[model samples]
Target chain A: MKRIAYPAAIQALIGELKRLPGIGPRSAERIALWMLQSRDARPLEVSRVIREVQESIHACPRCGFFTTDTLCEICADTTRDAAQICVVEQPTDILPLERTGVFLGRYHALGGRISPLDHVGPEELRIDALIERIKAEAPSEIILALGSDVEGEATANYLATLLRELPVTVTRLAQGLPAGGGLEQADELTLSRALAGRTAVKG
Target chain B: MKRIAYPAAIQALIGELKRLPGIGPRSAERIALWMLQSRDARPLEVSRVIREVQESIHACPRCGFFTTDTLCEICADTTRDAAQICVVEQPTDILPLERTGVFLGRYHALGGRISPLDHVGPEELRIDALIERIKAEAPSEIILALGSDVEGEATANYLATLLRELPVTVTRLAQGLPAGGGLEQADELTLSRALAGRTAVKG
Candidate 1:
């Protein structure tokens, strides 16, 4: 007997859905079916919104953050502290730091960290742009907010060396146990980092 | 401090993405970001495919399956056995049964089962069309290949009662330990059903 196959349009839609970050074959099929069969216009709304975003949004030239104009919101805002610039690997990383409400400074997205295995070097990142920004804007501090992984460390170290000749103080985010995380869940590296970075009690 | 929020377009896109089945806030944000930042034209392709599917695909008028034409492929095919009509809850359910390579008959999708709690009645489903088909085509057997859940059982029993006076025989898929499933994993209800429906040895 000849095998039954999904129509070409449906198969194509499923293939597209599977390219999403976490969606697999079964999830793609389910999503495709839902989009086709759902009573509401949500799927169409998604398509419209995607087009709207694509047409309007672009990366900020100065900071590498998503923007609709000449500069991103952070870069454009006059009230944000220009003396301190927090650096991160990607634009997505800025949101969490903003949510914390601790950092009132502006941000600079590096696009990605330097990874030798992935063939990404300093030249591939926004390092030159960052150096230019430091020279022009004269921020007192450059806080490295990259991850604690090997690539993150290498990138931070490399940035610190590059910025050494400049008049800015380079700092990195402390490596330690996460807030609300229990000691029992801490790995050996995390425990050692916590111990090494311990601060004196205020009392 | 003023709270930082995503731009209006990005937020709208995230909201739309979250409406998809199984996608939550984080997943929606990730997908929205990926769509905005991906180097390839995949996101635009998805938008185009969605529009294409919406414009072309419609439920088959006769069988309620997805089709771009007058009737679904299964319904259009003349070689399929007209004597046996398999009934399913949704059009999506037919694919798995088709993949099993056992059933070669035409299918009737009920669209959904009779669920009083959800206010879905027989009138809301394709029961009338099924009965009409039975009277017009006079198939030999009607197989209820629905899930073994409460709603499925209620629907199957209701259909059997409704079709009692008809010339066709009513049957359902067997309830037992699944193929490749161990007896130890079988629940009490499944075990009881397996025992009650045991077939005689062929030796």
Candidate 2:
């Protein structure tokens, strides 16, 4: 069936919007049209924000976390524990961990994990920068707060092997059943890991 | 929980992105970060398209469809029938009907339907423009292709009553089970409508 042809500019905007995650063709079309039809200057405002963010935001010099300034906020804060550093796969991972409020140390985002299938290796990530930070800061512990996925495991293992002779101790996140998770819903592997990683309860 | 503070520009962008439909806080953060971290000039490209679409697209003077030119593509086409106009509640509704390839008539987008709950009346819609077009063109028939919702039904009935004194005939989209829809899964109302509107089977 022949489709109703939108203007070239509208079509282009829709196509670009569809490139974003979770945006489909219908969603892109709706957003584009809504922007165009907005009574206020919403389209111009959105454009300005996108351009400004792109021009200003970049990876922190010390850590891989995003920042407009030369260094990220965490890196610039002297009050945070310098002796401890938590390493994560990407900058997005830092937020959830921060929400937990369990760790008081600073963070080092690895940009991404080492994925062999995707042709991404240690060189592609911020592994070198992480090593340099360890050497310079001499952190007492490096907590690898990575996903339980294969790539995350591989990256943590690679870092552990690389830092075997280093002064700092390396550890990974514990593997077990999730908080409030039902035993019936827990997969066999997760149940087994939970059993193996059980800790002694206080009397 | 102490959150890692993103740069002001990045945070502003994320805030603006969260205003879009279906986008939550996490999705906004991911999209904002993705745009900033994009190796290519994707952010710039997206910005350029948004600006272009905003500047160029406007409502069609005749049919209220979005167009860069004075007339939309459908209105500009000579092959389509001008004497039969299909009316819809919004410009977005036009596309799906076009895909059916069933009708080859011109369109009249009412912009919105009459909704007393939302304080929307016939005057708030493009009803006047529709009446003017009908008077000028004296179309043989007008088809109201609106949603099956309450507001849609109200608008259709109101339009039917308004056009009763006019010269042209009026009709609406058929009510029944959708094409390729299974009888077993069909809702009671839909099944009843299908039965009531059933046509004679030819040998």
Winner by TM-score: 1
- Name the regions of candidate 2 deviating beyond 4 angstroms: A1-3, A182-184, A188-203, B1-3, B182-203
lDDT of 1 by residue, A131-189 (tens): 99999999999999998999999999999999999999999999899999999999999
TM-score of 2: 0.88
Top DockQ prediction, candidate number: 1
Model 2 whole-model lDDT (C-alpha atoms): 0.88
Which RMSD does model 1 reach against the true structure? 2.3
CA displacement after TM-score superposition, residue B96 of candidate 2 (Å)? 1.6
Put down candidate 2 lDDT per residue, B77-176, tens digits, no spaces: 8888888999999887787788888889999999999999999999999999999999998899999998888999999999999999899999999999
Worst 10 residues of 2 chain B by lDDT: B1-10
Docking class of 1: medium
